[model samples]
Target: MTEFDAATAIGEGGTAELSDGWVIGEAVNGGILMSLATRAAAEALGAAGSHTDPVAFSTTFLAAAQPGPARVESQILRTGRSFSTAEVTISQGETATLRHTATFADLDANSEPVHLQEAPPELPDPESCAPAARGGFAEKIRILDRLDMRIDPATVGWAVGQPANDGEMRAWIRFADGREPDVLSLPFFLDALPPVTFTFGALGWAPTIAFSGHVRSRPAPGWLRMRITTRNVIGGLFEEDAVIWDSRDRVVAQSRQLAGVRMPSAPVSP
Candidate 1:
């Protein structure tokens, strides 16, 4: 099993171990926490039922998680013919660190046509871009070792002290361990990239208050392309919207997050 598979695996009664390998800074990556909870939820649904694939997931980060043993708790909210709802929580000992809720269904049975969908953003070949985890942010994000993330050069001004101030970023991402993207890995991919606020030079400890991700389809195997954008940054808060396109350019996942941030500093009068 890959490191990701190992870290996300829960044995017995939802017991799991959060690894230091996925740390973003001092805390474990929020997406990793989501992955752990999602696994527990999927397991709860079990192989006996058709409602096994996660269609949507939402999580609230109550506190930062550190590398250590954590417990996962899952509750089946409702099981229906078309959809099933579940609640999962990741806690360290007696302290709860994150709470999650998700909806599941058999994706294979979902062949409905798309009424409206956005085309994938145009990007250079994965090899043509620069690694996403570099420069100032590199020092803070340790998860880079496990991911092959290449950022579009045009969107990498922030790393070179020339932040675009446009609140956007695009990148090509995949596992450094060569594990292919699948339904279970979608949550991680959605939240794995550097924050969009980095485009404005606000790389300070911007904590995600809440995150929601929707899985539209199972991704085709190959490198995934990602585009993250923000339309507003106000009142010390920013919202980031992300979309992931699979190898075939199909939109596989979409996510939005709200987080507290420190806006770029203005000139100080001498």
Candidate 2:
């Protein structure tokens, strides 16, 4: 099995052990945790004779998850000829860490197509952009080394003390191991970008409260182009919206998340 499949593997009774290699400072990356849940949900659907693929997934992070054994309990909420829905809860011992709901469907190949949106945002070629600089924060979190990310120079002024008027960040991202994009990997890509909050002078970690994303279509091979934007920050909370476009220039997924704005001096919840 591939490294991803092994990391996300579910055993008898829907249990899995998260590997320490996937941990970031004190907790496993939220995206990696969500991907495990998504994989378990898909496996449940398939075992029930449903051939559909996950098209949408939403998850709420209720607690931090350490690198250890966890259980993924899934239930099929509904199943029809065209689509299915499932709920998955990932827990360690008896405490739930993440809960997710997913909708799966078989994509129609002969359906009529309509294009309403324009092309994706323009940015310098990935080869021309430099890899994102790893600061002290990254030194403490080794998980950042597992991703190959190149950020648009114009969008990184905040790193040098110049905050952008609008909180926006654009980058090209892919696994450092060169794994091709897939439905399960999409969650990781969506959550992998440096928080848009950084562009607006919020430098500390932005812990996600809730995240929702939709997979419009299967991704084409190659690096993903992504854009993340934050419109407002109020009372130490903010919302981040993101779009992921594949190498073909087609939007494969989009996501929005609500996260707490944590500062260096602020107290963090366990």
The residue ranges of model 1 lying beyond 4 angstroms of the native Cα positions read 47-50, 133-139, 267-270
Please, what are the lDDT tens digits per residue for candidate 2 over residues 1-270? 666667789999988998877776788888888888888888888989984577889999999998889989999998878878899999998899999999888744412273654368898999988887777777756566777899899898878898674779999998888788887888888998878988877777789999999878788899999999987677788899989999988888889999998543432222
Minimal lDDT window, size 10, model 1: 261-270
lDDT of 1 at 105: 89
Query: In candidate 1, what are the lDDT values of residues 1-270, reduced to their tens digit?
Result: 998899899978778888888998799999888988888888887743638789899999998998998889889998899999889989997789999999998876773566677798889888799876555757668788889999999998987799898888999999999999998899998888888988888767779999999999889889999999998787888899999999987888999999988876662111
Question: Residue 222, candidate 2: how far off, in angstroms?
Answer: 0.5
Per-candidate TM-scores read: 0.95, 0.92
Error of 2 at 219 (Å): 0.3
Model 2 misplacement above 4 A: 108-112, 263-270
- Per-prediction backbone clash count: 0, 0
